[model samples]
Target: MRLTRCSGRSCLSWLSTIALTLLAGSTLTAGIALDLQDPNSIKAAASTCAYNLLTFYTGNNTGDVPGNLPAPYYWWEAGAMFGILIDYYYYTNDSQYNDLVTQGMLWQVGPDDDYMTPNQTKTEGNDDQGFWGMAAMSAAEQKYPDPPSGKPQWLALAQAVFNDQASRWDNQYCNGGLRWQIFTFNTGYDYKNSISNGCFFNLGARLALYTGNDTYAQWAEKTFNWTQAVSLMDQNYHFYDGAHTTLNCSDINRVQWTYNAGVFLLGASVMYNYVKCSNVEESDTRTDSLLSQTNGSALWLERVEGILNASSIFFATNPPNVMYEVACEPPNTCDTDNYSFKAYLARWLVASIKYAPFIQTTVMPWVQASATAAALQCSGGTNGQMCGMKWTQGSTWDGTQGVGQQMGALSVIQANLIDQVSVPVTNKTGGTSQGNAGAGGGGGVSTSDPALSQNAITQGSRAGAGVLTCLVLISVIGCSWWMIA
Candidate 1:
């Protein structure tokens, strides 16, 4: 049974709805759904959602996919939508969306390749660029076919974004971390946010593994350590929102977000695998020595496991083991930026399993149950296929449909497939086995520093490092069932 955290009117209304549906003898299986073990079924669901995204969100220009909020279009959500499409491409190995990815990303980068454009104003936040940068990195990781003819290589574009992000790093605040915004007047400019730092950390980890470069690895470790040092992430492995540099970086925000944890979780897994798979003994040089040190230390890997277990416990629910935001759920309090929170959580849960093979038994139940509920909520909207913002409320749509909603739903569906088919084949870089599109081109600046590398070591693991056995609850969400794989 689904347990909600809301009370009074909202809770009563939701309960009445659930009661009415049960009285009608109606189960949640109305539209198409997938079995978690069947790759074909997962692909079919993802393909339908992929088409739904293009149908509802695509504008006159492919790059003009609008955000749910005002400003008509925002780079961050658009970048997130792009990431969803990239997920579809990777999971299904379908090339149809390749052109869409190419056109959408290329149109946003200006002549300088810094992602600054007249259509885009006040959009220079490191996190904003990091969102699109992560998508570009995904494309690069998948080796999405190069843009037709004269376009920049996919990996090069990602590097340009990363170069710009690295330039935003400020040591003046909290020892070291990227500021939330580049412009002084923008809200949260002086305040660092988890998503900003998490995105940068994730990008650094991915680029390090992708390029086999020590410099990016150093940057990733540095970002991870800074967050830890500033108390942005606590002893319990719970990630807080951010801290204010203006207050001498005191006064922690203490707000935790699902996406923030999700990004860093995935990044940590990448770092773990990077250490695990690298040839640390290849040479006795400084880089090799550093890699060897990181590899021998299980600290990062253990932290990844801790965060996964903590997330499963803190974000718990019972509609067949569904995971909720805890903070935003039971009340439907999620705003525009929060709409896609659960998708990020689901994406990385599956990624951690696929890449590092670290604690699938702990993370898989959440993915399975959440994916089931997410699919059940998709059959009630106008098109008979739109997904809602809250998956825990019930099987009814919340009358919301946009890039955020579609993306949130589509990613959960895509990630669920990984558990069904098998772990995706990944290279030494801990990415899916795909050819590189090409190397990055412009905005190239080395992030390498001897002092930075020397100071990059992470703290040792703390308590609660024991493995968590996966929780399995076999119940019906729809007309589907599965054995834990």
Candidate 2:
């Protein structure tokens, strides 16, 4: 079958009309009606949902960058949208957005081939870079089409990101963990967050599974230990936000976000599955130790279960099985970043089901119920199908719309078809992307003087630095105005 190649505003307009045309007859007071059990019906719903989400993107327009979203949406989110699109293609086998996805993924690889694009350097956090890295990792895992011969390959790009982040494993703060922001000038540099460390762990476990490298697995283990040691992740597997180094990371931020839990959950699940699938020989003690360690697969399985059990907070008891962001959804205080957090949670939860099949019984009910609730909330906006942030509101529109809300809805709705597709493939299991063990070795931030702040400069140079900093802040604040307004 020939796939339709789509690009720019014309194609986006055409795709946006797809759901409206297909679902016009099935509309209810809630929104587009979806058949939860039918794969084809789910696919159609996903198509429309994805198209509506794409409407918020202006990056494909003439003057804008290919992989970026306009003001009010940060650069990290555009990376996430591409990851969702990658999953969209993997689940539905739709090539309609393949070109766009490829363009977006490759466009921001930055000068060093890591995700540290100069434009975003001022505000780029380790978590921000990790999100983009995970997108490239997803592309490699999904066996998405490779770039042209001269450009970076999918697996190599993921490896590059992993190697770069591994270099930033700071020892200066509370044992060892990555700082939230990459550059010290950024506000959150002194903070050590779960999402940043969790993303590194998540990427490491997947890379280990894909490449059969014990080094990646070892790093995953170390990261998990560090997170737990710092109390960012408690004994109950409840992942917290972060802790400031100024207090020696002793005072933990108890705020729980779905994405943080989701990140660690998927990483633990991947390690559990990896241990179960490993083929280490008993005679090779070193290899056996690497594969099992002290806790072995049992520890990871326990972690996987503990995380899922604790995640019950995100689901609404009133609705019985529907999912909601407990931290922000109830108070209606989710900022632009908070708005997109549930999408990653939903995305990882369904994915964890694939790695740990036993979770299917527990996960499917939430997936099915939440997908329907999310679809019902898509009844708002000018097009009559725009998704709202609060799915727990049921048919009530909640009077809001944006890329995050659309992404959250699209992610959950498309996730219903997860059972129909193949699980993520590894290099040993028919993955075709090329590998690079040393991709970003020389490009990451320096670890020699961890105490040295990038913001610390001479008074003579402060004028120039202040001017540049102001420009970046102005740009960021200008972009943020629309979202807060």
Candidate 3:
């Protein structure tokens, strides 16, 4: 049966009212009903889910910041939320949120066009900045309408972020990796984590594929090697949290998160696709050497599958296919940030199918089961459509609701339409976003040089360092309890 598309706010509002009224006292729950086999059904469900998710966002209001969310949510999450919206538009072709997404993304490009806006500096980490960068990358790839002329173009924005992060690569501590925090005064400054490095690597591999730049590919290879060398990633491809540079990154934080694995999985898959699709001339030895150095297509395919297999840890054993945060969801200790991690995993997992199509048999089942489970959990809050964080609970709401919950639900449901949309576009594939090779500054690490010896730290007064230290200590203790429980 063909599902009618909910095209605008009025139509969606009327549908929501009818849904709430019909299910008010019925045995049926108030969550959106999803039909997995129907493409129109998936798109309609995603449109409704996206609408509910945007209801929490006041960033588009008259007095509020264009791209920012309210309290309890940080600036970085706003960036991530916009990225989700970009995916929503791409998957469903719903142009309703395009202007909002464009405004939010461009407003936070900071003074230098990197995502280091002064508003988030005190709390901004490398991973934080990288999320915004990834959003810009998505805009370019999805061909989300470009910003008006003279503004920072999507591709250049992504490149600027990559260049800035490449400059901050710290060889002084962990051999060569981005720290968890961008500024020295931040609490996690002494720590080197997977998400930060993963985001950098993810961006590099994508930029390489987008622009056909060997430099981006070279840096991507370096970052992937650094992660494994530091033992953050084991031989089987299980990614750990991170460790303090003070300990020389030897003592690993063994707790794993979905985003960590998801980020690297997409990067590896992109690298695999990039190499397999390269039609370089026989005479270009430098390009040939880069491809050979990455072990050509065989190694990347292995890494992608290895990471996917290891990701089974995030799913339930008895029920068998629903995804959750293995580190925190069991104990109900998922923080605001942890709640959003699964969305990326779900988003990236479906996305990897485009680059590595062989994984579809393995990936789509998980996505289908999880999306089904996720839709049923959206029976919370006054509206009766707000999503809860735990999908493993099935139809029973976990008694929680937030932007993260909604984002997670929207991502997986929309992901069911992955096969219906086009794969990401590149310059060679008719991408229209203008590219700037030297975006942020130095144009990232040199293609010829493998060493990342640049010092990008800025000295700041450690006036609030004590407070930040206490918070970090508390967070670490909380993480321990979650893992132990």
Expressed as tens digits, the lDDT of each residue in 310-358 for candidate 2 is 9888888655577888988888788998989989999999988767777
Error of 2 at 410 (Å): 1.0
Every candidate's CA RMSD: 8.4, 14.7, 13.0
lDDT of 1 by residue, 397-461 (tens): 66777656667778877886664443322233234322222222322443444465333221121
Off by over 4 Å in 3: 1-28, 441-485
Please report, as a residue range, the 10-residue window in candidate 3 with the lowest summed lDDT. 463-472
lDDT agreement with native, every candidate: 0.65, 0.78, 0.80
**TM-score for predicted model 3 compared with the true structure:** 0.86
Q: List the candidate 2 regions with Cα displacement exceeding 4 Å.
A: 1-29, 281-283, 292-294, 441-485
- What's the residue-level lDDT of 7 in candidate 3? 71
Better of 2 and 3 by TM-score: 3
Ranking by TM-score: 3, 2, 1
- For candidate 1, give the lDDT: 0.65
The most accurate candidate by TM-score is: 3
